[model samples]
Target: MDFLTLDYFIKLFNIILIDLVLAGDNAIVIALAARNLPKEHQKKAIIWGTVGAVIIRIAATLAVVWLLQLPFLLLIGGVLLVWIAYKLLVDEKEHNIEAKPQLWPAIRTIIIADAVMGFDNVIAVAGAAHGSFDLVIIGLIVSVPIMVWGSTLFIRLVEKFPVIITIGAGVLAYTAGSMLTGDPFVKGWFDENPVMKWAFIAIVVIGVILAGYLKKLSKNFISINEQGQLTIPDSIKNEAQIEANDSFEAKVDDQGRIVLVKVAKSEG
Candidate 1:
């Protein structure tokens, strides 16, 4: 495809989407790993970990792209893509956000987890690129930090609008289907019957949506406890509490009476 052509743009767009979706989990892992450190250490850990993650991700993606050029490797990649897409759509929610690690430990954990989990990212990007190096690199450069910094926001948005997750999952499944069709083992089949290739793509996309919808329905019936100190059930209520705290103060009257009261911080 010509670099400036519509096909190129579409390919780049899909790469960006894959990067955005897969990258968020890695970013969250980094943030959570660093969250328990001393404030200063936490900042350092995030910065250094992000830098390390970027370098590792870039290297891994390049390696995967190179390997993908081999005959039949695309079939492996395509199967991996489908697995990743399914996991993204149906994986259980991560309830254990890791405590902040010590400086060296946090960095180590971040690097190790990212190195292992990052293959999903690399394969997804490679599939999206359809073997275009420039497009893959550009997509990574643009989407990585957005995925990192904006992950918390993305998580909140997913909670607020659950359909976004379903749509994102469907996109990944579509990308997976495309990857499968492009595989050397499948290429001839796809070429001979383009309708079959399109049918597979439709099945993947629809299957993801149906699965997500059913999961969403089941989740609705599984009632989460609405009362918890750590759980913020409503953003408005949470913001109101924060504002109240920002303006709060203890006041003393002439008789030494305490006029304003708030929950006292506990010494853990």
Candidate 2:
């Protein structure tokens, strides 16, 4: 099927799926980077941070796709993907650290951190799109805000409807399967038989499920408390409180890194 035909839509859908599927970390990073700012600056931080993220993502995707044209590069990408998958399963901690004061510095931190932490996403999206720039741009533009604003919503949905996570995992696995076929080592068989393609898809799907299940099992060993509000975490609660005392009726921790402790109005 030529990319100019109906397959274009399929490719576009796959690219968008890849973007949405991989956007959780981007949202978290943006939220965390801006979380430390005074409530007044949160919106600005998010806007600037998102702009930086979008720019960086486009550049990264373009660069990766360009490099993908090289001989044996797909094999290297495939190896990198294994590491990416392992990291996805094993690395649960957020990568972007909280920034201190100052707007540009925080924004810079967000961009840099996103560049590093988001490399995997870039490669994954590029591979899924299979060299379609239109699909890449469309996917990124459409999904960025959804990732930015709907992160909490996504989390809530995933929790309330556990199947959402399962479906997402399945998608990741399917992408991974497609990626494996494009690798230099396996590229030969990819065009040889339709059965091979289906088999690759099955393997990726099952691998992702098994890996996700193991990760879930690991989380079961840890205990997490339920919080009432979507406030920040405790580690930075005092800082936010101190900052909150100075002005604005309510502060937004744009970075979303801190765990907030709700203070009584009378206490302040």
Best TM-score among the predictions, by candidate number: 1
Which 10 consecutive positions of candidate 2 have the poorest summed lDDT? 228-237
Candidate 2 deviant stretches above 4 angstroms:
1-6, 86-91, 184-186, 218-268
For candidate 2, write residues 1-268 as lDDT tens digits.
Answer: 3555787877777666556655665777777787888989877988997899789999889888777767677667755665565455445454538765778888888888877877877887777777667777877887777878887787677558866556655665566667667766667778798797898678767776787678656644424458633333343445455453533234457786544345555654
- Count residue pairs with overlapping backbones in model 1: 1
Clashes per candidate (backbone, < 3 Å) = 1, 15
> Cα RMSDs of all predictions?
10.7, 11.5
Q: Give the TM-score of candidate 2.
A: 0.71
Assess every candidate by TM-score.
0.73, 0.71
State the C-alpha lDDT per candidate: 0.74, 0.70
lDDT of 1 by residue, 97-140 (tens): 45645898888777776777777888888777777778877888
